[model samples]
Target: MDGCALLPVNSPGHLPSHHEVTRFHCHSDSEDEYVIIELEDLENLSVAPDKRSSFEPGSNSAEATAQELCRAFRKYWLQTDSAVQLSDCLSSSKQRSVRKEEIPRELESSLNLAEEIKIISKLRGSSGWSPPRSQIIFNIHPSVKRDAVVAAQNFTCVGCGTPIESKYIRRLRYCDYLGKYFCDCCHSYAQSSIPARILSKWDFKKYYVCNFSKHLLDSIWQHPIFNVSCINKTLYTKSKEMDRVREAQEQLFHLKKLLKTCRFAESVLKEFEQVPSHLTEELHLFSLDDLVKIKRGQLLPLLKDILKSSTSHVDGCELCQAKGFICEFCQSADLLFPYQTAKCKRCPECKTCFHKACFKYGGCPKCLRISARRTLSETPSLVPQ
Candidate 1:
C-alpha cells in the first residue's frame, strides 16, 4: 500500500493477457528493504514507432525529451512525498564505479548528450524539430579559424622575433634577401626605404646591395647633386696624395654619363665655367681647363654649389628680366656704334650683369654701383625722380 504501481488505463478482452512491465525499486529512509512495482511503459505505448524513433538514445531530440521527462518526474515525485530525500543518482552511480578509464568515458558521453540537447533546443520550433544537417556545431567566435591557422603554422615574425598572433599573420611579408618572414613595420622599411645607417657594412651589402642601384637612382633624381660636405674633406685630399686619381677619374666618367642622361650636363658645364679659379683651388681636381672632362668626385661639390647659388640668386633678383642678348642695365642697342654695342654688360669688378629693370631697382653689382653713384651725384638733374 505504501508502494506505487502502474496499471494500463484501458484493457480490452481481445488484447493479450501478458503485457510487458518495467520494474523500479526504492527504499524508505527508515526501512532497509526495497519496494518494487510493475509500471506500464507509457511512452513506448502511446508514441508511434516513427515518433519514438526521433527520441532514440543516439538522436538529439531524444536527449532533449529525456531531460524534460527526468525534470517532470522529479517534480511530481517531490510533490507526492515531501519527506523524500532526493540526490543526484547519476553522480552517485559515477562515484560508485571503480574503473577510472570508464569514468572518463561516461563523463564524455554525458557532455556529448548535453551538447546534443542544447543543439536540439535551439533547432526546435512550433512546426516540430528536425536534426541539424551538420553533426558538428561550428564555433561562432571570429578568431577561431585564425587561431587554428596560427597554431598549425607555428608562425613567428622574423623582424621582431616574436610569436605572431593568428589575426596578424596575414600582415606578415616575406623578404627574399633575408630569407625570412617580416612583420609590417620591418617589411615596409625594407620595401620603401634604404637600409638604416645603424646597419653594418656587411649587412648593407648582404641585405641592401641588391636594390642599391634603384635607391641611388631615386636619390639622384630627387636631388640631382649629391652633397659630400658631411664627409671628411681630408679623405679627398688624402686620396689625391695616394695617387688614386684613376679611381676618381673613373667615378667622374660615370657621373658625367648620369648628368647627361638626366639632361643636366650642359647647364652644369656652363655653371662650372663661370666659377672663379681662386675659389676652386681646394677643389683643383675640377679644373676649368676642360669642363667636359672632369671626374664626378670633383664635380660633386661644384654641382651642389651651383644648385644652391642659382636658387638663391634667382630668389634674390626681384627685377631679373628674360634672358636675351640686349644689355640688361641700359636696355639699349646702339645702332650708330653697332660694333661697340656688346651683347651683354660684363661688370669688370664682380663679373656679373644687371638687367635694365634690375638697374632701375638699384640692384646693380657693387662694382658698377660706385660709378653709377658718382655719375648720379655729378648730374643730379639727369637722375629720374
Candidate 2:
C-alpha cells in the first residue's frame, strides 16, 4: 500500500450517470399534483432561444405572448399530471410483484450451504444503485450503536437485504464502520481502520468492515483527502508526536519546491516522485493511511530518507546548488536555502532567506523596501487628504 501511486493531479469531474433514471415527479405543496418527468421530456418542452416559437405565434406583443405561453404551460402540466396517474397505477402493482419474485437467493447460497431458497427479499423494491458515484468521501459516519439498532433490523444482511433468521444469523458478521450485519461473503472478516474512529478518537484499531467499506477506504489510501489543520486542529494540539510529523511534512513540502525546477536534480526528483504529493506539495492534506503510519512512527523515518536523498543531490549538483540563497541581512559568504531549517529561516512577509541569528535583528530587507515605496507613493495622497 505504501507503493500506491498518488491519484491523478487533475481529479475526474462528475460524469452524468448512464445507468438509471427514476421517474422525476415534482409535487406542488399547494396544488397537490405530480407527473412523471424524464430528462428527455424537459428537452421536448423547451423551445430554442433563437426560435420565434418560444413565444405565442398569434400575439405580436412580447408581454402578451409570454402571458399566453405561461397559461398554456400550466394547462399542459395539469393534463399530463392527471393522465399519467391513472395509467401508472395498474402497472406499478404488477411491477412490485415481479420484483419480489425476482429476488435472487443466490446471495445466501453463495455464502454458505443453506439449501438455496428465495425466502428473504428486501421489504422495499430496489433494482440497483441509481445515483452517480461520488469521487471523494470527506466524512465517515460513526458506527451505529448495534446493541440498540441491530435488534430492530431482525437479523438481516445489510449488503443484499438477505434475511438471516435462526441459525442463519450465526453466518453474519458485524461491520464496524456501518454497524450492520452482513453475510460472510460481504463482510468476510476484512479489517480496516475506521476513518471515523481514527479522526474522532485517534484509535488505530482495525475492525471488521464490509467489502464495500473496505474497498472504499483502500481506494483513497494515497489521495490527500484529509486536511488536518481544518478538519481537526486539536489533533496537533493534543498529540505532540503528530505535531512533530506535521512539522517534518511542512519542511519536506517547502524543500520540494526548490528541487521541482532544478534540472540537475532530476535523478532525485524521479525517485522521490514515488512519495505521495501531499507529503511533498500540500502541507495540510493527509490520507487516512498517512495518519495510521504517523501513529505507528513510520512516516517520519520515511520522510527523513526523502530529505536525505534530495539534499545529497542538491549539495553535489552545481546546477541545483547554485539555486541556494545567500544571507542578505549579514551578507554572509555561506549559501542558505529554505530546507536548511537549522541555519536559515525565511521571513514570513517577503520569504527572503537570512541566517537564523541575523533575521531577528535586520527583519526582512525586501519587506522594508516595499514598505518605503508604499509610504512614498502615499505621501501625496496623505498631504491632500
Candidate 3:
C-alpha cells in the first residue's frame, strides 16, 4: 500500500500560486537572454533540424525526470489485488498459536499462503478467470510417504524411467493402483500406478522412439516431454542436434522417394541436354581505310541524323532527353536529358538539365541536350536481353 505522489509539470494550475510563480520565473530567465528564446506562439516554433537546439536541451536528466513522473502517476492510477490477500494471510496467521521455535515455520507457511492467495486474487481480478484447487501438497504424496513410494517404483516410473518430480503424494482414490508418488496430472490421467515391468517396457519404447525420431530427422524433438533430459544440458543439446540430423536424413529419403516416383533420372538428363553448349557472336566490320572519318560538313549531317534516329528510337521524357539518365527528384528525361535505368541511372539538374551522374563534367554544358521519347507508345526499341 505504500506509494508516493508527484505533481505533473504540465498541471501547474493545481499547484499553489507561489509554485506557479516560481515555474514562470525559472522559464522567464533574463540573465541568460540568448539561451532563452521566447516562443510566444508554440505554432511559430520551427522544428527544423537547425532550430531545435535553441528549444529542447535533449539531455539524460530531462529523460529521467519524465520517466520518474510517469512512474509516480502510474502508482496512483493502478490498483493491485494483492494488497487485500496480504492482509488476509496476516490476519489468519495472527489467529494461530505457535511455539517459539515454530514461529519461523509458521512465518514461512504464511508467506507461501500469501503468495498463493495473491496469485488466485490476480487471476480472479482479470476479465477471464480460472481457479486451481485450494490444497497443494509440498513434497510428499497425499496418501503415501516419500520413501515408501520411491522404493516401490525403484526411484523411477515403472512405465517410463522418467523419475517423479517430487516425493510429495496427494491422497486420492485408486492412487495406489499406480506406482506411488507420480506427478499429479500424470497420476490422474493414467488412473493407475505403473508396474515395474511395464516401466521397463516403456523405457524400451522411449529408446526406440527417440532413436527413430533422430535417425529419421523428424521435428518431434521440440515437444516438451522430449525436452526433459536425464543427462546434463550439454548432453541434451547434443541429443537434440542428433534429432535434427535425423530429420535431414528423413527429408533426403523422402526426396529420393519423390524422385523415383517422378522418373526424374530420365527427364533431368533430357533437360540438361537441351541447354545450349556454346554461343556465336559474329558481325561484319569495315576496314579502317574504308571508314569515313572527318569533315565538319559530313560530321554535322551524320550527327544530326544520329540524333534524330536516337530521338525516334529512345523512350524518355521530352523535358530531360534520353541522354542516358534522369534526376530522381525532378524525374526529367528526354533525348538531351539522360534516360534512367539501373546501370545507366543519373540525376538531372533542375534548372541546367545537368545529369548528376556525369560528375566529371564542370558546371557549363558544352552543347544543348534534347528529348528522346514523347510518349510510352512512341518508345522505339527494346534493348537485347
Give the winner by lDDT. 2
Residue-wise C-alpha lDDT for candidate 3, range 185-275, written one tens digit per residue: 2232322111111111111111111111121112111111111111011222343433332232222222223233333234432322221
Better of 2 and 3 by lDDT: 2
Q: Which stretches of candidate 1 lie over 4 Å from their true place?
A: 1-225, 229-235, 238-349, 352-375, 378-385
Model 3 residue 339 lDDT score: 20
Provide the lDDT at 55 for model 3: 18
RMSD of model 3 against the true structure: 32.5
The digit string of per-residue lDDT tens for model 2 on 1-385 reads: 1111211222124333332322222212112111121122221222222332111222232232222333332333222221233234323423422222222311321332222221321332222211111112223433444332333343455554454555555556787765557666556688988765676568888988876556545655554555555344567867776887777776777678888878776777776666676577776567787887889887778887888888888788787778888887888779898878778888877888889988874458888899999998877764554
Rank ordering of all candidates by lDDT, starting from the highest: 2, 1, 3
lDDT (Cα, 0-100) at 102 in candidate 3: 8
TM-score of 3: 0.17
Clashes of each: 4, 0, 42
* Every candidate's lDDT: 0.31, 0.53, 0.25
**In candidate 3, how many Å is residue 382 off?**
16
Report the candidate with higher TM-score, 1 versus 3: 1
User: Scored by Cα lDDT, where does model 2 land?
Assistant: 0.53
Residue-wise lDDT of candidate 1 within 1-385, one digit each (tens)? 1111211123322433332222212211112111111112433433333443222222343233233333333332212221122233223323433322200101122234445334433443222222111110001112223323223223444333345655666665544332334445334433422222101110112232112222222222221111111111233443442124323333333233334343324565455455443222222222112221222245445545654544343334332212223544565652111111123233445645444233433355465577888988887595477
Question: Distance from true position, residue 382, model 2, in Å?
Answer: 14
